[model samples]
Target: MKYEFIKSHEYLFPIEKMCKVLKVGCSSYFKWKSRPISKQLLLKEKIKQEIISIYFASKQRYGSPRITFELNVLGYKISRITVAKYMKEFGLRSKLSKKFKVTTNSKHSYLVVENVLDRNFEAKEPSKVWVSDITYIHTKEGFLYLTTIIDLYDRKIIGWSLNNGMSTKETSIAAWKMAVRNRKFDKGLIFHSDRGVQYANRKFAKMVESYGVIRSMSRKGNCWDNAVAESFFKSLKTELIYGNKLIKKEKMELVYVFKRKWTFS
Candidate 1:
């Protein structure tokens, strides 16, 4: 190690002086520098390059384990620990997902329904239970609000809408309309959401009631009651919105593209 260190600094300092200062002999330093790179060292360099390539290809979202798996799939036999060591040597790290904030506006005169969903996130059939939530995305223009409706049976985002404002007509209602148009539901289908004003407002209530669907709301200040919707938002932020900047127009386009991808796949 001392000879290697002296060799690395030989260009900046006299080789003999560096070897003496580093407590390594000049002969040893020269010998080490003249020696051919070992096969293990060459392989380590190759693995480091592959790890960097895979890390950026995944948008820095893959840590050592996933990168190791991908490397193995690409015919490179490697271990997670070795990958982590190389990543540390190169100061490479996966981008961590940012925490998303809850956007429920429960302070309103609108009626708040009971917590009928009650943490029951499973549905036996399609459209039996639907969960919805609104979350805000930061854009250069301003904040864009996204409303999403998920079918609990398949955990698929059935409908979604993105707009500059969180108005009922533009946000929740638009998403609800899209979901209704896309899927046929039975009479006893449950629509669950946080007690946000948009969901609890009379207009939204009337809209759902007209379809003979039962309304279920989370208890006051309780986000876990609407865990499915919250989980969806967390995924959306982590996978799509985190560490990226988009204007309102671009954000809308992204939302449309994502919805299409989800719808088809």
Candidate 2:
């Protein structure tokens, strides 16, 4: 284990010095290197290479546990701890979003409705209750705002828009337009979102009211009221956005997953 760590950091530190600090003899280490490789050692090396391939293929989003699960599915009988140890030896770690950026700003004079959904995440039928939210994706150039409308019935993203601005027209209005166009506006369908100005502004309210649908807003400073949208945002950032490669804005274009219907600008 000590030798492996030393080998991993060899370029950063001196080998003889590392051997002395680790209480390992330089001659002994070289002897082990010159020894013939056994089948067991060969298998271990192959598995280690596979671990590296899986880690990078996931864009460094997967941790030791998830990688171990994948390896087991691929017929490798390895433990999670062993995988974790190998990853640590190679200084391999999952990428995580290190910074926090607030996207919800409820400091507007617009009216906000009551929490009609009321922590009820499930819906009985399609278009029963649709929740919308906004999240920021960090990129090399700047932050990108992603607005999504999800149907609680199937937990699918029915409509979405990605823009550089958080204006009502770019964020909420665009997503809502796509949603109403794709899904039928049913009676008693509750539209839920946070108390952001984009959702509560007069323009958005008028558009939603015209459809004869119910309006719902999460309570001020209470995220649990819109738990579904908040949780979805968290998962999306962690699994797809955060810790991934920094995307350049000019070259950015996302293909919508639903039937290749629309492209997100």
Predictions in order: lDDT: 0.82, 0.84
C-alpha lDDT of residue 129 in model 2: 95
The C-alpha stretches of model 1 lying farther than 4 A from their native spots are 1-55, 62-102, 246-248
Tens-place lDDT per residue, model 1, 1-265, is: 7776775676799887876777777777777788999999898788889999988876776778778888999898888998999999888887765645556788889998888888999898998999999988876666778899999999988888888788899888999988988889889999999889999999999999999999999888788888888877665665566667553457657777667556611
Indicate which candidate wins on TM-score.
1
Candidate of highest lDDT? 2
Clash counts per candidate, in order, are 0, 0
* Model 2 Cα lDDT, one tens digit per residue, 65-144: 88998999999999999999999989999887787788889988989899888888988888989999998877788877
User: Which 10 consecutive positions of candidate 1 have the poorest summed lDDT?
Assistant: 256-265
